[model samples]
Target: MTALSEYERLEAEGIWRPDPEAQRQEVILSLGDATLVIADDRSATALAHWSLPAMIRLNPGARPAIYAPSAEPGEELEIADETMIAAIEKVHAMIEARRPHPGRLRGALIGGGVLLLGAVVLFWLPGALVDHAARIAPQAKRVEIGRKLLTEFTKMTGQPCHSPAGDKALAALAERLPGQQVIEVLPEALDGARLLPGGLAIVGRNTIAGPDTPEVVAGFLIAAQRGAAGERPLHRMLDWLGPAAALRLLTTGDLPDDGIAEYAQELVQHPPERPNNDTLLHAFREAGVSSTPYAYALDPTGESVLGLIEADPFKGQPAPHPVLEDAQWVALQDICSAH
Candidate 1:
């Protein structure tokens, strides 16, 4: 369903052959809730609707891929557009992944029987379920959950800060961190950076305000990445919501809106988690950023963060890459000014 939402209202043109003997004809194809609709080009009338889950692709890797409703003899559709082909493949993959796998169920049943023999099953089942759900969740589902949580977060923190120049600067910063999707700056309500589901990272205005260098901001980003890698955001949510919620998510690729809203409130009230010194140092070193600025910002006297200061990666030498140019840094600093 999340995959459908991502590719909703997508339409493309393709050549359709009604049968083996018929000539190919142009048709407009559109994606439905759970079907692929073929429409007549001129009249815009539906010609055929194929169940997406039941659709079959004939050509595995050839261009201008051919498809039929199923293995049965039927009309064939030939599509050459890469976007449409990718969309269909993605939707089918999501559907296939959601189906119950006999092998997996059999393994689980065997494991359950073994656990039943033990006295500590109750204490262990919940954690096992949460871990299983987190491990199996697809990237698309994680993105959907993150987007929903961000919407709820906005109710308390207000919309994310945005300015033309600031947005460009943020994009440039994101480019430095491989696999990072988006960096959101909240004008208020956040103390520092927190990683959401997917690759989203949220930070507070304090991260960029008052004598803060781009290195400090980069440090926060690195810390967020490390935290997310250590514990997946989905795992955190499932642990908070309990076993029933995790089971529901496994069956249906969604969580209750009310539960997510409650979690958002809880997140806004607490300080974001921090990674250990070793993890933080590793991230900073890999990113080619100095940790001294961020360490000093955490503790002005540098008493508590002495490790970070003493072990700064680029302490005496210059950074291999600049976090941001002077102009971009100026724009990033003023991201929350209008808000």
Candidate 2:
């Protein structure tokens, strides 16, 4: 095995802090493609090693594990058959593409592995990573992120529907949405709507205030939920940000200040390629909103959404009551829009 020159360089530069009182320090090993580096950081020795394509770290208290690219499917090593670690491995494979240089690649992979460990501790281990995130994420920051996203969603569709009617309609619909969910109607989004992690959804006020009724807005909400349930808004978010930021969200529960802008832009520009109809159907039925409204909103040509309405999930069922009261709707309608 060749010496990992890159790792050696980083160590020489004091990038690899060897904590003798900490635990073990095995020379880093790499996966076959050299996309990731695995280190046994449980020991205290400093015998530096080269990189490999795949490796595992075994700490006495930690779960025995393997960190392979997601491409290496199936259980590499059965670590109590934990699903979260499996999910993490799969995600790693999905994101760990071949880097240009072995050295930098080694650095990124190892760094990612450490971050991965952090995420596992933060999210998958046992406690509530989502709740932790909520607590950690400032209300002011969340609201700010929400406002900027509203601005971007508006800019993308070129539909300035800041009219009172549109605002009123959005208020009515917002009242009916889930309390845990973050719902906002922008004056844009002519083409599509999006749901994000942390209980947030964005749509064009036009989507809500178009010829369609409040039921349609409700249907779109269901569809967004369906999309989120299938792949988790968090996964979609992490996918957009790449794994590094995803890892940060998992641990710290907050992204960089600019991360929200990047996420909002991606949400506006990139709609979900395929939202599962079956899931959407269930969501619609559960929400008591007819699928027709949402279907038409997706495509007014009646070609795409027409079928959804025709084969309505609840048929004559009415959607549940609003998340906000009539007055709350009015208040939200004017929320920051006056400026």
Candidate 3:
């Protein structure tokens, strides 16, 4: 776009030192995005970016605007007036406020003519889109797409599984995991757990076989399944896809190839919204798993997990399953850290 002003040129003069410790400069003013990043000029090479939003002012006298590189949160110096500073601060505030509120697909899009509008798109070209995707995307492509989406985040299998011990334990529990459920308990699932468009249930390493017992893992699984029941897996997928992309998928049954990367990554890095307790409890009951075990697994003293136990679906009886052989349990524990 526009040419840089003389002052702007001076502001951009400083470089983001990669080394944070080497320079040892305290951050004066930090704000914006998701991280609180500081700037260092000397050890420009040693700086590491944080997830919280932050701003750093090199010259206290002149409040210069700083921009960090997309790949690195290293800082750059620049001059700015009150107007610029206020604008930047406002943007920072807005993004921070929105960060905690996650996106969901239910009532957010379920009103009046939304579903009708989506249905109309289907009539325009019946089977055309699905057929096209089928032609281009064979089983291999679908598997790849599924894998890409799956690996994007650290998913919890709701089993607290870690090593092959985790896998074997889950395998034993899997016999009882709702017959319709397709659960995947990874040793190091990045995201907690989520249901996908298909019947795929993503899980994290800390889920079923983490440090907790099978009870906690089963609790989360029940919660995820309940969430899926309230909202279709396709709806959850569409919710994460955003409005424009959802419409495109409804119209053509094909998602932009590149969009999958970020979507998958979000699965591991971000936590999904939890369904209401009523709905979560309903699913837990359907799964025939106890709430006490999961509740205790969630929090021993019941401070944090008190609500979950109080909301237990079945206070009746524990499901039947074999404990893994001690050796197998050890294997599952090491699964997440394998790579």
Candidate 4:
């Protein structure tokens, strides 16, 4: 407030326009403590007081400088007095020097660095921790957790289809598919095949009752493998289940029942991502299973899965072996129907 002592009694004549459409009138402009006062010179009545900090000059380094209360709106003062203009500029410079300017190059860099650190803490750290947890988990532990998930899934979907003939047939089907160590057919609440922490893959009874060939079922298992994307199913599960779940499993050597149940419920609610054409074709080739039946099962007309059908690994030839033997296919189809 006491900075501009030299301009204590500074007064100037200025043309004031209250608005754009109003008539301009000569007014007395005086600087007060932290304010610029505009008064009717003849009537000696104050017209307006603009806070010095808020006042903005419309034209800098121009004669008869124009100013307004703010960068917004139209009330303006046109002043010709050089002394008043110079004093205003000096006060503005002092104010600018004291204000925090984060937009400055050095400040911007510091602010950006802070934001980057915050992003790593909020997003990247949790993901990295989950990956570490998954990487360190032994295959034995993964199989243990996977069977536990199967037990939980059964609670929501009922017991998986099983019979003397069906179990043997399903075991044969799993053997035929390869890479499918644990395969079960759920009665309900399973949208698609969900590969669990170990090499377990669960499918719906509808797919069995629906598709003519077991190759469609094998396709579902291959698609579930794509969900891992070269990562283990445990990693995929922990990623979706979040950092808390990963930490729990890592520290306690088991996930909380609530978290496991929630994951089981969520699994039925969401379908696993489909395997892309290239991935499915590669998997089919590796397993010696034809991809055409599976491609058609995905899209009856094969319109959307044209790539899968055309790129079938066994396009010109039959599968190296049947996906299921004639009797096995019939027995597998009757697996869920038995009980």
Best by lDDT: 1
Clash totals in order = 0, 23, 74, 0
Report lDDT per candidate: 0.85, 0.52, 0.52, 0.84
- In candidate 3, stretches whose alpha carbon ends up further than 4 angstroms from where it belongs are 1-144, 154-172, 179-182, 187-191, 247-253, 311-317, 320-331, 337-339
Q: What tens digits encode model 1's per-residue C-alpha lDDT throughout 119-229?
A: 455777778888898889999988889889889888888999999999999998999877578899988788777777877778888888865589888887787677744
- The sequence of per-residue lDDT tens digits that candidate 4 reaches over residues 1-339 is 323977548888999999988999999988878998999999969999889999998988898899999987879999999888888899999999999876796888999999999999899989988998899998888888888889999988889998778788888878887677878999987766888877788998877879888887877877777655656688878988899988888898887777777887778888766756787789889988888887888789989999989988899899888888878888888888855
Candidate 3 global lDDT: 0.52
Put down candidate 3 lDDT per residue, 172-229, tens digits, no spaces: 5555666323456665445356665444666666654455445665566666666644
- Better TM-score candidate (2, 3): 3
TM for candidate 1 is 0.63
lDDT of 4 at 182: 75
Clash count in backbone of candidate 4: 0
Regions of model 4 farther than 4 Å from truth: 1-119
TM-score of each: 0.63, 0.46, 0.47, 0.64
Off by over 4 Å in 2: 1-172, 179-182, 249-254, 316-339
Query: Least accurate stretch of 10 residues (summed lDDT) in model 3?
Result: 1-10
